[model samples]
Target: MLSEKMIEQLNEQIKYELFSGHYYISMAAYCASKDLEGFANFFIIQEQEERFHAMKFFHYINEQGGDVKIIGLDQPKTDFKSLEEVFDLAWRHEQFVTKRIHKLMDFAIEERDHATQSFLKWYIDEQVEEESTMLSLLRKIQLVGGKGHGILMLDGELAKRQFTPPAA
Candidate 1:
């Protein structure tokens, strides 16, 4: 069973996860406007993954006998000066999310909630991969000079990215 505080925090995380999806879709739109179809495809896949993450929390909350509350999202940034800037922002965003997940894990440890800790372990692992992906992509963009042939090559690579839900 989850404490009321834990439930509330988890609900807040759900909102964050959903907002991540929204934010990525906004990024996708920006990429599309720039005629970066591959980049757009990448963000679209990212959006789908975020939604999947939100649903995981939604189901977990219910399984733990907590009421799941849907929260409103603020507008995501829709404008970007360059693809490198977008990836830089995305990498920073992932860092922020990693911190949030760590804080939640600390709370779980404090409460001696073994089940919650175990559940959060998956997220802790996921955050590592998330941050790494963003950083790697950002570095690639930087190395590629953020435009022309290099950017096109990266776009083609990202276009092949598909959202594959992790096995339950």
Candidate 2:
């Protein structure tokens, strides 16, 4: 069974994940408006991934005999000044998520919640990949530097991204 505090924290994380999905979808819409289909596809995949993450937490909490509480999600930004800005925000968000996952792991250790700790290990690894992918994209964007052809090439690369959920 999950401790009340842990349950609360998990619920909060669920909300954050849902908000991440919303944020990515908004980014995808912005990219579509800018005629960056590849970028839009990338964010579309990201949005699906975030939704999966939230559902994973939801299922885990219920499996642990905890009630899944729904929390309010803040509105996500619908517009970005440039692709650089979008990638910057995405990288920053990944960093934030990594911190949050680390905190959850710390709490699990302190509470001797071995099950939760084991489950969180997957998330820990996932965050690493998430940050790495975003940083790589950011670097590519930086190298491209507003060149139309370079941007198109980068977009094509991003469109190739496919989400494979980690096997539990």
Best TM-score goes to which candidate? 1
What's the TM-score of each model vs. the native? 0.98, 0.95
Alpha-carbon RMSD to native, per candidate = 0.7, 1.1
What lDDT score is found at residue 21 in candidate 1? 88
List model 2 lDDT by residue over 1-168, tens digit each.
899999999998999889988988888998999999899999999988998899999999999999998988898997699988998999999899999999999999999999999989989998999899888888889898955899999888878978877576
Residue 159 CA error for candidate 2 (Å)? 2.6
Across 60-164, the per-residue lDDT of candidate 1 in tens digits comes to: 999999999998999999878888889888888888888988998999999999998999899899989989998999999999788889999999999999989
Model 1 accuracy (lDDT, Cα) = 0.91
Model 2 gets an lDDT of 0.90
Against the correct fold, how does model 1 do in TM-score? Answer: 0.98
